[model samples]
Structures are given as C-alpha cells and as structure tokens.
Target: KNEGSYTIGKVELEIKLVNRGHVSGNVKGGNFFKASGFADMFGNASKDYQPQTLIETPILAENLKPGESRRFRVVFDYPPYFKGVTQFTRIFAH
Candidate 1:
C-alpha cells in the first residue's frame, strides 16, 4: 500500500489595526477533498477521505500596531481520524 499526504495551500488573512486602534478582516473557506491521487496505472483512485464541517473561530485584535506584522499561531485539536492529504488551514488576523 502506498500512503501519501501533503498540504496543498492555506487560508491566510491580514488585519491592519489603524493608528486609531481599530482593525477589520475576514476568514476565507475551501472545500475538503477525499482521495486526490491516482491509485494505479489503470487511472483508479479512492474517495475515502470524508469532508468535515469547518469551525468558525473568533478574532480579537489586542495591542497590535499599524505597521507591525506577526505570525499568529492557531491552537486547536484535530480528531485522531484526520490523517494526511492536501488541505487548506485557517490563518488568524489580529
């Protein structure tokens, strides 16, 4: 059996808090794909990778600068059943 996985892309967002201490932004979404690779030379594939509903996360911009940029780490628990494949994750804005 050949098992392979990779990250195809990511959902990134940037919020610039103006000097007035206010910012605004939104999170984009994407569709989840099950099996994405060819199974064999006969052009066969699998679709066992079930799609899951995406969760909405809240954003809070606290103590951010107008020109300063920082990397926001997203902390969440993934179900044990989620293995490997191409997918896009969420990027937070502050």
Candidate 2:
C-alpha cells in the first residue's frame, strides 16, 4: 500500500546553546552529571512528537560531595522554523 507519509525536507537553522561552564566533570573522584544529553529545537516531525514538562530545576545533592563543580541553567521554547512542524501539518490536512 505504501501508506507512509512524511515531508519536511529541510529546517536546519542549527541552534545550540551550551552553558557548559559545568554540567559535571571531575573524573575519578566522581561527578559526571552530563547524563546522556539533551537540548531542544527540532521539528521536521512526521508523527507523534510528545512535549510536556516545561521546567524544573533543583539539585541539592546533599551538599555535593566529591570534586565539586556544578552550575545548571536550562531554557527552552523551540521553534524558529518548521513553525512547530507547520502547525501540526496544518491541523493534519484540514
């Protein structure tokens, strides 16, 4: 049937913000909190693009032990192009 559909050929403004003053890095002593990775801004989406959980930041870590080095700040509200995947493909093909 070939019922596959997706069209967003291009939308690469390439926006990246790194306040990597310290996401975490101390080595041996321990404190490598750059867990996995994440920083948003992308929507050439085809289906399902779940987004919820706006903001929350609070990491005391019982007065951080080991080699200390922590500074956190994350901001997000992506959409400089693809207008949120073309407004959901114009409301799913009207």
Candidate 3:
C-alpha cells in the first residue's frame, strides 16, 4: 500500500525464511476496486464466482499512490497432517 503522496513503483517484497512450513510458490498480489472489481497485475478480471485476483510474483504497480493499497496473498505448504501439539510459524515481509 502506498500511503505517501508520491507514486510508488518497482515495489518488491521478500519473505523471511520459515522454520516450519515452506512457501509453496511465488507471492500473489492484486487490487480491488468497487467500480472494476478485483483484478490482477495484468488487469485480468477475476471470475464473478471466485472473485480472486491474486497473481504470481513480479507484480509491478507504478500507479499505486496515496490512498491506494494492493492486497497480497501467500500460501504455505506443509509436509503432511499431524496429530500432535499445534505448531506455529512466523512470517516476516520486507
């Protein structure tokens, strides 16, 4: 999200290493507007039923300026299901 008045461009995000689960694939991000609905970086509209606009990484949003925010979704894949103490993992983004 670009809260500043200047336009933000070439934005990149790096996820810190995880001790438990692992990142499944590249991060996905998109923008949602009431007029146009959810759309990916490529400007492809999401399905009406699904309404998911998250796309693979390498997203460039030079147009994101003040009051404009982008949404990102990350998925962590685990080895398998386990019936033991609940495990926790902390994710840090930069």
Ranking by lDDT: 3, 1, 2
Worst 10 residues of 3 by lDDT: 16-25
TM-score of each: 0.29, 0.17, 0.33
Cα lDDT of candidate 2 equals: 0.28
Writing each residue's lDDT as its tens digit, candidate 3 over 41-88 gives 334453433222222243435467777887766653432321111233
Clashes of each: 0, 0, 0
- Which of the numbered candidates is closest to the native, going by highest lDDT? 3
RMSD of 2: 23.4
Model 1 earns a TM-score of: 0.29
Model 2: lDDT of residue 13: 22
lDDT by residue (1-59, candidate 1, tens digit) is 00114322233443221111011222223333322334322233345543232343534
Top model by TM-score, which number? 3
**Model 3 lDDT on a 0 to 1 scale:** 0.39
Q: How big is the positional error of residue 63 in model 3, measured in Å on the Cα after superposition?
A: 3.1
